[model samples]
Target: MSFLSALRRPPAAVRLNASYRATPCRSVSTSIPAASDKPAKASATATHTISSCTEGTVLGGLNWLKGQAPVTALADEEYPPWLWKLLDPKVIPDDGPGGQGEKVRLRKENRKKIRDVQFMKTQ
Candidate 1:
């Protein structure tokens, strides 16, 4: 018997469906900036060097990836809740860390600077 079946686990399809239902998808803007200063030809040429492997090659690699228990392998509750949370996209928070501060520090360094300035003013 398969390990999953031996463990009396739910089928992969059912787990995937439950995970999909629990995750909320945010719209990702794919529009490119038209006002970029870089020359279009140069950017296009740079992009040409970045490539995806053949679908067959990717599929072949999946067996190894699956064996390694790739990122989403935590549909099983036997794993830690943290891993389960990460794998379940439906648990995504709209205002979670990645939602903002992509290029910014979330910490309020400004507050520290303000406090320093106030201390100086009082002194």
Candidate 2:
């Protein structure tokens, strides 16, 4: 057939015959065990009592409850700069780090810089 003729649509009869027909779905349960089956009991390697078990013992997991550090409130002197910035009323209006307005302005500035770099590369 010529290239133009080959490019044209196939005969309706050929198209109908070649159309995909899905096979009926069938599910197999080969991996599933019978209802009457019971799981085998796991054998214990060693017996342990609470007193016998150490912090390092793998048989029963670590004793995190007993090892936790006591909860204590931090003093003003111990507070980090970011925490101080949040607490201080004077710093709130200054538009330094941690301010919502400062963050938005910085983001806009970064976007402009990126766009400028991209425009330069294109030129």
Top-lDDT structure, candidate number:
2
TM-score of 1: 0.18
Q: Candidate 2 on 1-123: residue-level lDDT in tens?
A: 664343233434435764532222211222323344345523323221112222332321112375665333343345454532332345325466788778777888999999999999999
Clashing pairs in 2: none
TM-score of 2: 0.23
Distance from true position, residue 40, model 2, in Å? Answer: 90
Kindly list the per-residue Cα lDDT of model 1 for residues 34-54, writing each as its tens digit: 445677644432211111222
Task: Please report, in order, the local distance difference test score of every candidate based on alpha carbons.
Answer: 0.38, 0.42
In model 1, what lDDT does residue 116 have?
95
Candidate 1 positional error at 4, Å: 43
Badly placed stretches (over 4 Å) of model 1 are 1-99, 102-107
